[model samples]
Target: MSIGNVSAVLVHGAWADGSSWSKVVERLKAHGINAVAAPLPLTSLHDDVAALNRTLERIEGPVVLAGHAYAGAVIGSTRADSVKALVYVAALAPAEGETVGDVFYRGEAHPLAPKLSPDQHGLIWLPEEAFAAAFAQNATAQELTVLGAVQRPISVSCIGEPVERPLWTDRPSWFLSAEQDRMISPDTQHFMAQRMNARVHSHQVDHTPIVTAPDVVTDVIVEAVQAVSTR
Candidate 1:
């Protein structure tokens, strides 16, 4: 199921670094797919998009840009012509002229979802306990520990600012609606997926499925990549 010349560029969401995609990366590699996790600064939307572009610029040929959680916004911001498809894994999809927070907080959040606020430094950090309670309750204790330890605080500015026209409108897209996601509600996922007319693959997975359910995450990504290759 290898797609020749097409590679994958994975972008992690807030509170997570590139390492969050480690499991998926290994699986993609085993399938002979060139996959790399693009590191986001979590500084601001502009900065995060810049970092994503930096990664895309380095990769040759077509790419399947897959984003997790908050990174859905980052992936859609890229104007790179090489991007042939977009994949959202329990990700947020903010429409044109809308801020990430707009869609993120559209519906009611899960009862267990942590109450988040920026600290004095204006950086929003997920509570450590939220890693297990909300982010990936299905994840093992060790997985939760590592997720919290390597967490990166996202800037308040990241979600507040309105995004430019999203690239998803111009490309084929696949959405993984994590039915059991606590961070982003399933209703919200269905709303975004339907609005975008994306091919939806709903699964009973947690928010951080890239860690808790790597195979499920990779399955959607590979489907998008294969779609792009055939095009």
Candidate 2:
């Protein structure tokens, strides 16, 4: 499978929807790379993984699975045979028995990071103002406003659950390091990427590079697609 011969499935993290990968999807389609964004309910890890699996089931050929933020853990749970590669974009790749929160709160929070608390519905939401301040500082004012408006709330149960064996252990993987990320620390990203022995690509981007730097993000995805296509 050549890069052009494979498809890609993109998974977005908490507080965002498939639209987060809109620009990346457009660029991939332009490259003749069929790509789709999986819609996560953000209700539970099992639910999100099942959602991704449904998307994977629809594709016929080799796939380059990509995840951002929380979806990294979602993708990790996949054992789909069609998946040829893994691309983690500032994603959390928690090992066996480790919950997302375990890795997330491993270190002191970044000073500019927003304080999070679940709402009455047991969902964690990014404050409307958080998009501009910490979530996506590289995004335009208009983008920040829209992000806040269209954000999805993540369930608390999802973060506290442990992940299955990470798919990266069996599949070739690539990692993107966000040097200026305010959500997940740069050090944590590095550690996760290094731990997975992934092909690491570091950038001085914000937490939401798929929105702030789509071209850069697309380039990395293309790299993964091309790599997996050869297999």
Stretches of candidate 1 off by over 4 Å are: none
Write the residue-wise lDDT of candidate 2 on 1-231 in tens digits: 466779989999999999999999999999999999999999999899999999899998899999999998999999999998899998899998899898888767889899999999999999877888888999998888879989999999889999878888999999999999999998999999988999999999999999999998999999988877765
Could you tell me the TM-score of candidate 1?
0.98
Q: Residue by residue across 92-148, what tens digits does model 1's lDDT show?
A: 999999999999999898999999999999999999889989999999988988998
Question: Candidate 1: global Cα-lDDT?
Answer: 0.93
lDDT of model 2 at position 161: 91
Query: Candidate 2, which segments miss by more than 4 Å at Cα?
Result: none
TM-score each candidate.
Answer: 0.98, 0.98
lDDT of each: 0.93, 0.91
Worst 10 residues of 2 by lDDT: 1-10
RMSD of 2: 0.8
